[model samples]
Target: MAGLLQRVKSKMAIFAHRKARGMLDGEYGSVFKGRSLDFDDLRGYVPGDEVRDIDWKATARHGSPLIRRYAAVRRQTVLLVTDTGRNMAAEARSGEAKKDIAVLALGVLGYLAHRHGDLVGLVCGDSTATRSLPAKGGEAHLERLLGHVDSHTSLDAAASRIQEQLEYTARTIKGRHLLFVVADEIAADDAMAQLLRRLRAQHEILWLTVRDADLAPYPLTGQVPSAEVDYCSVADSALLPWQPAASAAVKAAYTRATAERDAARRAMLRAAGITEGEVAGSGDVITGLFALLERHRRAG
Candidate 1:
């Protein structure tokens, strides 16, 4: 696990340098503050001003719309809410385990936070149990947290109850935090969307999905060999036998259903005002994460 963490860290080091460049140039918000802004000054409202930034009192006093500007705070908090469900152990098209990709993704963020002298914490769990580490600064502390994530998150665990983790974070974590939710290709059901909305009210939310092979569009032909797949619940598990021969119609229907689910998930995230990115299990996770952060940085 230590070796794996080192490899991830090494791969992410380059991206981290890029992040530093953004900070120095003030092009990308610095890691310490990133998107976190503190009230700085006020100005006349521009045509494109965000409504939320409008100062109603100032507008009334000045007889015109005015907007408040803010400066990025010097320090911030980052919390990683990771899913350790059994499905996360599934292999991706890249033939790498989703859990490893998840770890790498978390590592990149953790390293960045550590470098910026910010607090980094973790909320990791599966269906059975969830563990949390309070936000703290230091490389040693980050290392321990990563080790814990690697040890506790497993593919053999029961189905993931991600809502439990989300609720836990909402209840326990206070103050504004940059929340990174790492999970599988689970559709954002209504309950999950509600939870995310609640979290977004106080925290900046970033969702990173580890893509699953099951959701990948594949060429479906006649007489495809398949195996039994088990779908587990808290109360019980059900194993469905795979069809020995699937018709083109069946394949098309499955693909359509998966696509719809994916689209719905994107919509849910958008509704909750969350930015999201996806990394293939076998792809370069560091690069994917850098891209995600780059987007966030530019937006911020």
Candidate 2:
């Protein structure tokens, strides 16, 4: 079988050709707060090189503007945090497996960190148990991390409780890290909000929510296109598309409830100083991640 990171790189390469090359890398690099001043080498300055980084002596000696490159004092550690449970195996809003979307999000961010010369780690689990992989560098380590998430999540796994993973991270991980979290539409409660605030104080946090499938029928259109399909929830509940809950009145209620829920989640994360992004399927992973990283950079 082909490697997952190759798939991620292919998507990035395609996006680069479509848009501007290295645009995603530039965005990812801008979010980190510090850079080392220990000089590594000097190179000819580019058009967008920082004016303050120009070395006059080097420029005069080389007969052109030169920029000093620094050896990174320390490699930043990015902790890929996610839930590997039945909920993650459920259908996403785009009718794709939610776990696949989670894999793409994690792989893209891990690859970005790898490209930035940082170590990447993984912390993922369901309600029953949590697992952590030590921070390590190299594409092999990243592939293992992605594989862990991909292989462990399934409909037969334990119920989703992302909070357990977060709590484990807070308890065991002593060092500060950039936490990239991907999960389903988890409700925001006081305890979860408090946990996020605590984590935010200790580390940089970015969230990507994999939207759950919309169970109700299309609103006010009398459309039952999927009425014949049998839908089953991760919790073993059968969801008939033609159920009473699919009525127009019920759809309206669901819409309002969903809006309120989404608003509450955004408010909670904003209060905790975390930037949140949404991806509906594999297709939206790259664009959603770009927006997420850009928002985090702007927030900083």
Output the number of the lDDT-best candidate: 2
**TM-score, one value per model:** 0.78, 0.84
Question: Stretches of candidate 2 above 4 Å error?
Answer: 36-72, 217-228
lDDT of 1 at 152: 71
How many residue pairs clash in each candidate at the backbone level? 0, 0
Candidate 1 error regions (>4 Å):
13-65, 69-73, 215-246
Instruction: Please provide the root mean square deviation of candidate 2 (C-alpha atoms, Å).
Output: 7.7
What overall lDDT goes with each candidate model? 0.72, 0.86
> What is the total number of backbone clashes in candidate 2?
0
Query: What lDDT score is found at residue 34 in candidate 2?
Result: 55
lDDT of 2 by residue, 240-281 (tens): 555666676877788799888999998999999999999888
Give the clashing pairs for model 1.
Answer: none
Q: Which candidate is the best by TM-score?
A: 2
lDDT, candidate 1, 26-141, per-residue tens: 32134334445445788998788667678889989999898888667767788989987777766754657777788888877777777676788999897777789998998778
Q: How far in Å is the alpha carbon of 82 misplaced in model 1?
A: 0.6
